[model samples]
Target: MRILLAYDGSPAAETALGLAISRYGDDELVALYVAEVDPTTYDASAFGGGTDDVPDSDEAEAVLEEARERAVQEGYELETAVEQGSPSDVIAEYADEHGFDQIVMGTHGRQSISEVIVGSTAEQVVRNSPVPVLTVR
Candidate 1:
């Protein structure tokens, strides 16, 4: 069984990783971290309107490294990647393209208004993914 684990270094995502390890220890585990690019973060810099520096890839790498270490501690070796895109789209597409048997992810558990406005990445992935998705809160 090939399992794709969506990790972002959040507490919830870590919990999801743990669940994946515990449930599918022998399966091939792929840890994926989507470094969502909010255009607002770079728009100003791109236009040279502000002095704020464009963020580096270091942060994304750090998140993946942490996920890798955690999986190692759980006795599961994982393949990892840091992708740039919307979280839900990247996760769902990657799972589908790679032919993963399942996808494990975490939800922020936001409430009504906030959830409606910002939307839930896990929920979107669950709805769009071609494979089964297991979401941990």
Candidate 2:
């Protein structure tokens, strides 16, 4: 089975990564890190105000590298990908485009007003994903 693992270097993501490695060690695992670009940044750039604070691919790569190392420590090799977009959108689209059989991700378990305003990435992915999603907290 092909599994898309959403990794963001968070503690919850670490837990998910370890779970995926242990439970689906024989499956094809791809660690995906989505570099979320703020839409306002793009809008500002379009209006001639270039922002240096935009999330870069390098940051995404670094997180994916960490995921790879963790997988290695667990005796598994992981393929890594870095994508630019909203985390949930990127994850769901990548899983569909790559024909992944399942998606494994972490839930931040945020229960604050900010969570209500911005919604949880895990919840959004679970609602939008074409394939089954296994979320770890």
Candidate 3:
């Protein structure tokens, strides 16, 4: 089971990792950290953690390191990447490109008009993915 765990260092994403680990065991997991930086745009602010306190590159690196450590502690043979693009597109493309058996991700739990407008990483991935996607909230 080549499981791709979409990690953002968020609480919900952590839950997704936990679920994947518990369900599929550590040996099958791959940890993925996407920077989601809009490559065409020169502005870095449009992507990354979206916090002024942390620079985009540094923040993404930190999150990747944290996820790697955690996955290692669980005994998974983990792989990582920091990509620049739309989150949903990157995730789906990576899964397709690498031939992952399943994709695990977190949903932000936004509802109503806000969710409809802002959209969601989980939603798009589930919709556009060529493989199976497990959404955790």
Candidate 4:
């Protein structure tokens, strides 16, 4: 299926990942993590606080690694990417640029934040994607 999974390492995103793993065949998956360069997080040397340690890039890498491991364990061919930018934009770009057939992702479950589609990444991706996006809670 050449699918892309947008993971944020959140419990919600993880649940979506679990669903995706169970639904697709091993040969039809590609996992992705977007760095989500948040302007609020911009700093010259912000890499030393545990509470503030979850930089989008690092978080993205961690999630992608987990997704790839899952795919490998399930015998699926896996590809990974880490790009810097908005989550929705990056996911859409990756899917389009890589010729993905579908996108599977998890949302944060924030149901009122319009700026972020209920404050969830999944919502934003679904709203901004050119291709079909399957959102898992």
> lDDT of candidate 4 vs native?
0.69
Model 2: worst 10 consecutive residues (lDDT sum): 45-54
Given candidate 3, what's the lDDT at residue 133?
96
lDDT of 2 by residue, 15-128 (tens): 999999999988999988876766755553454542233357677777788888888888899998876667888899999999999999999832355546889989999999
Question: For residues 88-117, what per-residue lDDT tens digits would candidate 3 score against the true structure?
Answer: 888899999999999998886323454468
Cα displacement (angstroms), candidate 1, residue 111, comes to 12
Which numbered prediction scores highest in lDDT against the true structure?
Answer: 2
Best by TM-score: 2
Q: Judging by lDDT, tell me the better candidate of 1 and 3.
A: 1
Give candidate 2's error at residue 25 in angstroms.
Answer: 1.4
Report the Cα lDDT for candidate 2: 0.83
Taking the tens digit of each residue's C-alpha lDDT, what string does model 1 give over 8-85?
Answer: 788898888889989987889998877665665545346453222324357767877888887788788989877655
In the order shown, the candidates' Cα RMSDs to the true structure are: 4.9, 4.0, 5.1, 5.1
Q: Compute the lDDT for candidate 3.
A: 0.75
Candidate 1 total steric clashes: 0
Query: Sort by lDDT, best first: what order?
Result: 2, 1, 3, 4
In candidate 3, the residue pairs with backbone N, CA or C atoms under 3 Å apart (3 or more residues apart, or in different chains) clash, namely none
lDDT of each: 0.79, 0.83, 0.75, 0.69
